[model samples]
Target: MKPAGQTHTLAVVGASTLLGKEILEVLKERAFPVARIFTAGGAETAPDLPVLDLGDSYQDDVLVEEPEDSEPDYVFLADRLRPAPEGTNLGLLHSAERLAEAEHSKVIDLGGFMLPKAGGAVRIPSLEREGRAPERLDSPATSYYVAPHPAVVVIARLLLGLSERFAVESAVGEVFGSASEIGPRAIAELQKQTLNLLSFQKIPQAVFGAQMAFNLLPRLGRGRTQPGEPAPLERRIRDELRDYMGGHVPLPALRFVQAPVFHSLAVSLYVRTREPAPLAALGEALAAPGVRLRRISEGPPSPVEVTGSSDILVDALTADPAHPEGFWIWAVADNLRLAAVNAVEIAESLKSGGP
Candidate 1:
């Protein structure tokens, strides 16, 4: 191990995407110790850099790994997470896999490249107190650490808190997604579609493959799978939830819908408990780290309200009218901010040896 106070070099692949921008902002906000920062993206799409260009720097292996020395302390894969059309935007995934195989730097995956069985540890620092965040973050065998989907973090933390205070029987979540979850392309498409519709012109459907403006979709029109098959986003949430929850609580039944919004995520969840859950006691239990509880008098939390917020906002917590043992909660979180904060926290944990 190197000296404790020695700052290290870092690289962020796909550093031009929305998530990449968020990660860089968070790193600067949190004042992460970095000797140098390098960015990489698609050759044609990447912005021009002064000297540390990806073409010369990344390919030289100096940014990825040193011959007999350790240089880059971390490599973050912050690519567009929403599954793109097959054979599109896969260069970052290739870089992540190569870095993981090299085991030179601690690779943190903000992208969904590392799956449940990929041997990468799924980390949520907010759950560290609950013994849910992985303990051995710097394990040699596990070079990749997955910063889970923001929805997974929000749902898992809420369910974990409830399970700690009551016997949770089952839970159902309706998660509303926004264009920012895909990338800048989806956001541009949505904006263009909205303008075209208002002006009575042809709308673009390349990114979303549907009329994303003033519309709600159960699945994207392009690259759609067979009936009953969960979309890519839903499948990612389900797989990561299971991996992180570790069977400690009932896995929530999830449904993802694409909403005509630009950022953040809104979730409507109904949970059934083994015993009658008192509203006051339930609120006390749901009060966990990285979660903010809003009063009913404050109305419900909205995606706009939670933008740029690191905490998941929980509101409209009420008991089910017919079933005393059931409750409903509406949650909103800045999808990029939440995931970015968690990824930074993971790096913090590694530095401090906290988890």
Candidate 2:
């Protein structure tokens, strides 16, 4: 299926971090048929891609994807990987399960350090397709494709499209996070602590060990919560919203702060409902189909107006005046342009599932 306007041959592998240059500017703002891009890393000098050839061990570019003179049908793991690494992919992604033995290699982990693996399968092709249960890059399954965490793809596709008409009985949120999501060294220490506290100077927290400028750090450098493990970014966003909302939706109650602004992402949802749904039926279930909802006279969608939007720009739409079924959902997502458009839309659904 990798045919729409061009052909394919991609690879970005930690390409000199900063979300590997925002996954090459979201794969050239989603034109991704990737006719040849290959920018490998590690000691990284590798960045001249016009059909490759910076070769000569691009500073040991981690075995340049099994080099048969440039091989990368799809590889985008944009930097920051370290959960377990021993025998190389030097610029990381052997992050675990040896990336399921790279069968014809298809690893799209936009580096959530091996995307929520409490036993795999957390895909979200805008919420699965083909007879169900997300498995079709020609069925066999698991050639590695992580990408699901842009706040669990904006809370699992806005609570699985509002649980197909108000079935979600609970959800409480507050994920703010922004300093360009810690990359250019926590955005150069949040612009050097907002210019050393607006020129008074001295606030140089060794890259967010604290004082994340203007601070909302509920736990940006957390130093507590040790008994009964769950508070490390709300237990990894409730185990990635139940591994991509599979239990048919339920667990929410989240709260991952640390925002001083640099890129997008400002969710605040509070939904609750099992029956009687209102407030224009939860604003038409948060404007369902691949979502876009931003009215209420357009006032509350920030993160600098969802920077380079790939939509999730919802605004403060309130409703629980006394819980007639309760509601409220404000959002803003561009977190690395929705994790580089969900890793080039899951490598264009595995290159359009074509054999």
Candidate 3:
């Protein structure tokens, strides 16, 4: 928890995109102790509000004329910058090279890439970076360390204290990523494809390989490289979980599929635990702090129900009597919101003490 009475100043660069906009919404919804908020964008298409013009250089802090507004204290950069600007404390919402040359107050990078030796920013990778030893922050560590995927964070939190009870077996995730996930280029392509029907019959294959409309892609990330190759995001999660749980827990076999829906990520876990954990007991465990267990007596949970929701919904749970050890569970959450919140939590934790 944040220290009492201490409000934090925040700035959100690229506030126009899906992830960036979602971050702002989460901040507002959670009632985060924000003293001031600054929004910046590259193009004028974003909301008509006060913003800071970077103009390709980090030196100048020229404020755009606004109706009567105040200055911001901290800034969250959702835009892509090779090296962050100088002077101000930054939250690296996108990946970039080392900006050690700049004297930033603190930097929280959303990209999972390894940081330079100088140390200043905190790298919060996806659920994949969980078990690995985090880079040390020599200077004032950034305010947040976060992942952009909410389902990952919620699942991680759920498993945090319950690692001893069950063992995750084969796991599958269905992602309904927002338009922002592919950025403006993909959205523009999608819109263009939607507008012209007769001659412009082009398949949307830029951000996602296949046409995403009314389709499902079983493979995501760089696809299967080779037999011995790493299992992209899913593999990373399993390895990291194993590490975080101190190897006492079994790593899950994961399969991720991309769905056509927008905004949320839903996951189904098929676990083989040592003992049979009743549905009531499992529900009680999921109801623990930070989770919103949905009580569903019927069909499977969908992305539409989880979109925009900050809480991770655990809907269905059942036992596989054949393999008495088998347990099935369902989970859903807003990827952007959950990821940003988890990153912020990490940032706060590092700010107070080393993680």
Candidate 4:
């Protein structure tokens, strides 16, 4: 295991996009102890953000100048291996897999490069071939683990901590993905079309299959599978949840839909409990640490309202007398922020020793 209380250095490979920016924000918000921070992106100018210039490699412990006082640690190829200077501490990777090949003291991946298996151990066929498995790490020390999307992981941990009687019956996710989720070109097109007044005469479908302005696309990536078949994202979530819950809880049925909003993701859950759960108790339970509960009388939650908010907004906690088993509620969160924050939390958990 890695030594505790060690000052670490972090490098974010793709730090130009919204998720990347949010990752920086979350790290600062949490006040994570860091000796240096490195941010790399494809863009020439990332205004208001401090990033290292990878123009050339510096000697061990060398410091470079930025426009401001802030600067990153070092720059490694997204997939190429670049060793940090000897005696370096930990690496927190977000949304970049190639960096995993780097020769760091310890690497905490925020991408889904590895999957937790039905059994206790994790599966990393790719890393295994490269001779970078759990066993490779000095027994119990210097171990590496893949962390799943932060939002999903944190929510799973929160729910498991709350109660065992509650079952996530069904979940509907309205994802307000950032423009960066698609790419830079797609973002440029969206802005161009917005200025052009949604006229298809000039703009063509680029990032998304359809023109995504003043309109919402229900589907993302591709078509949903058959009724019984799970969508790709949904399947991943179910599988990961089962692994995290350790089969102690049942997997919830899920539905995912994409909205036109620029950022954030909102999910509404209808839970069925083994015993009747009162609305007040349910609200209080959800309002526990890692979740934010909102109370509303008339209108439903929307993506526009919840964008840029860190907490998972939970409202519409209404008990269904017809369905005596449980009740329903709405939850909203900044998807990228949730993902970024959750990733940091997982790293912290692993560092502290997880349950």
Candidate 5:
């Protein structure tokens, strides 16, 4: 096992993406023991990190060939879209098997392609319920580590806290998303469309397929959920939630939405507890390490408030008038930052012990 201060090199696939950039930022912000940085999928080169082109002719290799001394100790797959667009990281992470075969490097995927042969279960470092054992990285059962979906991170942290107090029966809510969830191109297109709309110019229908600027969508970009399959984003949350919570509670009625913001998620959730609890008792449950309850004086929580912050900001909480056991909770999280932080947290979790 690696010592805590022993520096490790990280190869960030899709380094040009929003989540990719955020991962780099979080790594530095937390002062992780990063010996060096390597980036993929960008035209302009970053100052310190060397670039690796994942071209079409790029050999399908897991141990990314680099200077022997600078070989990545771990890889962070942050591109949200799979089969990365042409000229992007040479489509790295398209197959998890190649990564698993790497003799030296460990792979931790944020959110992208499905892993090889069932992949590993989703992990939310913050709400690792019931003192569960950390998912072993070298276990044959785990092809790679998946960072828990950010929206689910928010829901899990908050709802589970309440469950510890009230035994939450069910939760129903819509998670509002931002362009950042779709990566850099989506953000750029949204910005372009917004400016064009204000200038009376023709809006670009690319990226999101429809005008996403100042608009909301049930789902965004390409890909569709097949029959009996949950929508891509929705499935991740549902599956991960179950994996973490087990059969202790029923899955929430949740839907993923694409909102017109650049970053952060505004989740509207209504939760029903097993027994009636006063508003004060339920409100107390919102106070957890990664969760911060909003102050009534601070106005409603929005993306602007959480744009660069680490914590998942939640506020606008109110108990249902008739059913005192049911409460409304609104949450906003910097999606990229939350996911990036969790990725690093998962890495830290590994340091405690790993094969």
Candidate 6:
């Protein structure tokens, strides 16, 4: 680990993005030490944010047009840069590569795109052993570190926690994703669609390819992600869970549905263990750092209530009547905030030279 007072230089690639902004907020909230900070992005990014002059080739250097300084020690690809768009599913791997090579910075991708296209180490701070670094983190070949999708984190953490006490047989999960998961464009389209529908006007469907105001979609509309394939979000969650779970537990059967809400993510999970486990014992296992257990009397959590909370709010625990080993769990997490926290925590671990 670096010395107590030592600091590192940093940069955020999509500083103006929803996740990018949240990440900055979390970094500030956690008081990450920094000797300098830099930012870059497309037209939507703030005018003052420096634009990196990355040429067409990987051989090109990461040239900062303003705020001349040495390359940052770490670079965070927080979201996709707009206008010069790098599609929804692939992210800006080319840009990330340039930043990592030319600038010589350790790149951490929060953009859900990188890992699926190109391999990387998945980091979930909550799951790591207390002090020892995971082998992936210590490996020289791992160039990028990824923060798992919020749904993946919630499901993985819950199952991992439960497995500590019971032998989990299998599980199934239904994730309700919100507009903000797609970024500001989707949020704006949903808002516009809502207002347009109320006014009896034709609703805009450009961003989501359908009226997303009050309707739910199994996948995006026409011109958006195709219905024949696994939704990108679902694929992402599945891939992440596979890596994070690391064969320690059975991978849950998952379905991702796009919900009308503008923020947060919710999951309804059914878990079957090898033996019947008491609710009291399961609750004890579920309570841990970065998680909140709500009492049944307090009512089930809603996406709205979990919007700003960093902790994953879990409640509405109940046992299945027919299957002695079966039970259901309902969990809600601030989509952006949970992801931001996980990213920041990963940075902290990297900063401290720990897992």
Query: Who is ahead in lDDT, 2 or 4?
Result: 2
Better by TM-score, candidate 6 or 4: 6
Query: Relative to the true structure, how large is the alpha-carbon lDDT of every model?
Result: 0.76, 0.65, 0.50, 0.48, 0.69, 0.74
Give each model a TM-score: 0.84, 0.35, 0.66, 0.66, 0.81, 0.84
**lDDT by residue for model 4 (1-355), tens:** 2324664565554455545555666666666665556644433223322121112121223221221222233332122222333443333232234333444423444444323311122222222232322232223433344444433543454354335335544433332344434444555656665656645456546666666767766555445467557656666665655555444445555655545555556665556776777777766655444455666765666655666665666665878778887666666666666666655554455444541
When 1 and 5 are scored with TM-score, the better candidate is: 1
**Model 5, range 1-355, lDDT digits (tens) per residue?**
2226687777777676667777877776676776666655532222322111111121122223322333367788775324445554423344455555665666778774545444575677666634332343443554367787788778777777776667778889798888767665666678788889999999987778888887888875465767555677887778777766666556788788888887788889999888877877777877877678876778888886787778888884788899877889888888878998988888877755531
Candidate 2 residue-wise lDDT, 1-355, digit = tens:
2436757777676676656666666666555655566654432222332121112222231212332343367777776434433343422243445444544667777655565552344466766652223233342456676676688778777776777666789889888888666565676667778887999988877767888878777765645577655556567667766765657778787878888776677888888887657666667765645467777876777878767667787764677788867788878887876777767777888788831
Q: For residues 122-209, write the lDDT of model 1, one tens digit per residue.
A: 8887688567443343545666788999999999888888888799999999999988788667777787888899999999898888
Looking at candidate 3, the ten consecutive residues that score lowest on lDDT are: 50-59
lDDT of 6 by residue, 126-229 (tens): 67853112234343575578888889889988998888778999999999998778766777777778888999999888778887777888777664455466
Q: Model 5, which residues run further than 4 Å from truth? A: 1-5, 42-71, 80-95, 112-114, 129-143, 221-223, 226-230
Off by more than 4 A, model 1: 1-4, 42-71, 80-97, 130-140
> Backbone clashes in each candidate structure, one number apiece?
0, 0, 7, 4, 1, 0
Best by lDDT: 1
The parts of candidate 4 lying over 4 Å away from their true place are 1-6, 40-104, 114-142, 154-158, 165-180, 183-202, 221-231, 298-301, 349-355
How big is the RMSD of model 1? 6.9
C-alpha positional error of residue 92 in candidate 6 after TM-score superposition, expressed in Å: 12
Ranking by lDDT: 1, 6, 5, 2, 3, 4
- The residue pairs in collision within model 5 are 54-90
lDDT of 3 at 47: 31
Q: Which regions in candidate 2 have their CA more than 4 angstroms from the true location?
A: 1-10, 18-62, 65-71, 75-123, 129-152, 167-175, 180-182, 191-212, 216-266, 270-321, 328-355
Model 1 earns a TM-score of 0.84
